[model samples]
Target: MQTVCNIEQLRTVVNAWRQQGLRVGFVPTMGNLHAGHISLIEEAHKHADKIVASIFVNPMQFGANEDIGNYPRTLSDDQEKLVAANCDLLFTPTPEIIYPKGLENQTFVEVPDVSVGYCGESRPGHFRGVATVVCKLFNLVQPDIACFGLKDYQQIQVIKTMVEDLSMPIDVIAVETKREASGLAMSSRNNYLNDAEKATAVNLSQTMRWLASQLASHNDYDKLLQQARAKIDASGMKTDYIHIAHARTLEPATQNDKSLVILAAAHCGKARLIDNLQVELD
Candidate 1:
C-alpha cells in the first residue's frame, strides 16, 4: 500500500484515481489496528473500486483528562495489517499536517442535538472534534463511499447526520460490530484491559443484549434501563450511561418508538468501554 503523509500528495493520488474512473472508499481510524478495523476495510472493498484508509490519532476528539499521549501508535504494525487487507492507499497525516493553522484557529463543525447526550455528555466537545476531523478527511479524500463500524453506534449516527445536514456527496456505510469470542465489542481501547478486566468487560455487551431481549416483553424504558444499569454496576464497573433511546436521534425512546437502541458505557479497570445493541420494538 502507498502511504502518503502530505495532504496534497493524498489529493493528487485520489484525483488520479478519479481520473481513471475508479470509485474510492475511505476508512478513517486511529493508529491501533485490530480485527475490527480490518473488518471496515473489508466492507469498503465491497462498495468501491479502491480503498483509502487513514491513521491519525486525532487530538481534538480526546478530552483534557483522556488518554491522548498514551493512546497507542502502532503505525508499522497497522501498515502491515492494511497491506495484508489489500488497502490501496494509506493516508497517515501528522496532527500538524491536518491542522496546519493550529487547532485553536481551525474551523470546527458541530451537529447539534445528535451529539448532545450519551457519549457526548460524558466527553464534552468530543463529537465536535469528530465531526470536524471527519469533515476534513471527507474533503481531503473525496471518496465515493466511507465505512464506519457499528460498534461506535453513536459516532456512525453523528457522521450520517453531519453528511446529510451538510449535503456532502458521499455514501456512509456501517459495518456490523466485530466482537471477541466472549462477545465484547472489539475496540482499540481494549488494549488497556488487564486479563481479568478483559474477561469482566464482556458483561457490558451481555447487559446490552439482555436489554434488547427485554424490549420485546417490556415497554418500560426507565425500569429496563435501571435494571441494566444496576446489573452493570453490580459487576463492579463504574457505569457511565446505560440508555435506551431512539436509534437514529439518540433521544430517549418513547413507548410509541418503533426503532430503538440500547447503548452503554462503563469504566472497566483502567479502560473505559462502550457497547450498544439496536432493536425494533413491536
Candidate 2:
C-alpha cells in the first residue's frame, strides 16, 4: 500500500489513477482503527478498483473543550490495519498541510435545521468543522465513492446533505456500524472505559434494542421516545438526546414510517458515547 502525507502528492497519485481509468473509493477517518472503520474499508475495497483511506485527526471538527489534544494518534497502527485490508493509498495529512494558511477565509458547507439537532445541538460548530474538512478532503482525494459508517447516524445525514447541496460528484455510501458481541458499538473512546464503565456502556446499545422492540410491536412514536428517554436517564447516564426520526428527513416521525433511525448520545463520566440503530419500521 502507498502512503502519501501531502495533498499535492495525493492529487498526483489520484490523477494517475484517473488517467488509467480506475475507479477510486475513499474512506475518511480520525486514525483509531476499529472493526467499524475496517468495515467501511472492506466495503470500499469491494466496490472500487482502488481504495483510498485518510487518517487525519481533524482539529477543526473538535470543540474548544473537547478531547482534541488527547484523541488517539496511532498512525503506524492505522496504516498496518488499512494495508491488511488491501487499501491502495493512505492519505495521512498533517493539520498544516490540510489547512495551509488563512483557513478562516475558506468557504464552509453547513446544513441548516438538521445541523441544529442531536449531536450538532450538543456540540456547537462541530458539524461545521466536519462539513468544512470533508469538503476539503473531497476536493483533495476526489474519489468516485466515499464510504462513511452509520455509527454517527446524524453525521451521515449531514454529509449526504452537504454532498447534495454542493453537487459533489462522489457517491456517499453508508456502511453499517460494527458492534461488540455485547451490543456496544465499537468506538475508540471504548478505551477510556474502565472495567465497570464498560459494563455500563452496554446500556447504550441495549436501549436501542429495546426501542426496536417497541417500534416493532406498535407505532407509538411519542411513547417510544418518552420511554427511551426515561430508560437512558434511569441507566445513570446523562442523556444528550434520544431521537426516533425518519432516517432521511431526520424529522421526528408523526406516524410510523418505513425507514426509521433511533439515535442516542450520552455522557458516562468523561466519555461521551453515541449509538444508533437503523431499521425498517414495520
Candidate 3:
C-alpha cells in the first residue's frame, strides 16, 4: 500500500488513477483500527476501482474536557489492517498538516439544530468539529464514493444533509454496524472496557432492541425513553441519553412509525460507548 502524508502527492496519485479510468472510493477514520472500520474499507474496495483510506485523529472534533489526549493511536497496526483489507492508498496526515492554521479562529462547518441533541448535547461542538473535518477530507480525496458505518447514525444523517444541502458530488453510503456475538456494537473505544464492564456493555444494544419491540405496543414516546434510560442506568453505565426519534428529522417521536432510531450513549469505566437500533413500526 502506498502511504502519502501530503495532500498534493495523494491528489496527484488519485488524478493519475482517474486518468486511467479508475473509480475511486474513500474511507475516513481516526486511527486505532478495528473490525468495524475494516468493514467500511472492505465495502469501499468492492465498489470502486481504487480505495483511499485516511487516518487523521481530528483535534477539532474534541472538546476541552474530552478524550483527545487519551484517544487511542495505533497507526502501525492501523496501516497493516488497511493494507490487508486491500486498500490502495493511505493518507495519514499530521495535525499540522490537516489544520495548518489550528482550530482556533478557523472557519468550521456546523450542521445546526441536529447538532444540538444526543451526542452533540453531551459533547458540545462535537458535530461542528465532525462536519468541518469531514468536509475537509471530502475535498481532499474527492472520491466517487465514501463509506461510513451506521454505528455513528446521527453523523451519517448530518453528512447526508451536508452533501445534499451543499450539492457535494460524492455518493455517501452507509454500512451496517458490525457487532460482537454478544450484540455489542463494534467501536474503537471498546478498548477501554474492563472485563466486567465489557460484559455489561451489551445492555446498550439490548435496551435498543427492547425499545423497538415495545414501540409496537406502546405509543408513549416519553415512557419509551424513560424505560430505555432506566435499563442503561440499571446496567451501571453513566447515562448520557436514551432516545427514540424520527430517523430522518431526529425529533422525539410523538407516535410510532416505520422510521425511527433507538439511540443510547453511556460511560463504562473509562470508555464511552454509543449504539443504536433502527425500527420499522409498520
TM-score, cand. 2 vs. native: 0.95
For candidate 3, write residues 1-282 as lDDT tens digits: 999999999999999998999999999999898999999998998889999999988988888988989889998999899889999999989988878887786788989767769998888888998999999899999999999999999899888888888899999999999999999999989988888999999989888888888988888878778878899889888788888878888887666457888878988888889998888877
Instruction: Tell me the deviation in Å of residue 42 in model 1.
Output: 0.6
Point out where model 3 deviates above 4 Å. Answer: none
Instruction: Give one digit per residue, the lDDT tens place, for model 2 in 48-141.
Output: 9999999988888788899989898888898899889999999988888877774576666777767778888899989998988999999988
Worst 10 residues of 3 by lDDT: 249-258
What is the TM-score ranking, best to worst?
1, 3, 2
Best by TM-score: 1
All candidates: TM-score = 0.99, 0.95, 0.98
**Which structure is stronger by lDDT: 2 or 3?**
3
Q: What's the distance in Å from true for residue 95, model 2?
A: 1.3
Q: Which residue pairs in candidate 2 have backbone atoms (N, alpha carbon, C) closer than 3 angstroms, thus clashing?
A: none
lDDT of each structure? 0.93, 0.87, 0.89
Q: What is the C-alpha RMSD of each candidate to the true structure, in Å?
A: 0.8, 1.5, 1.0
Could you tell me the C-alpha RMSD of candidate 1 in Å? 0.8
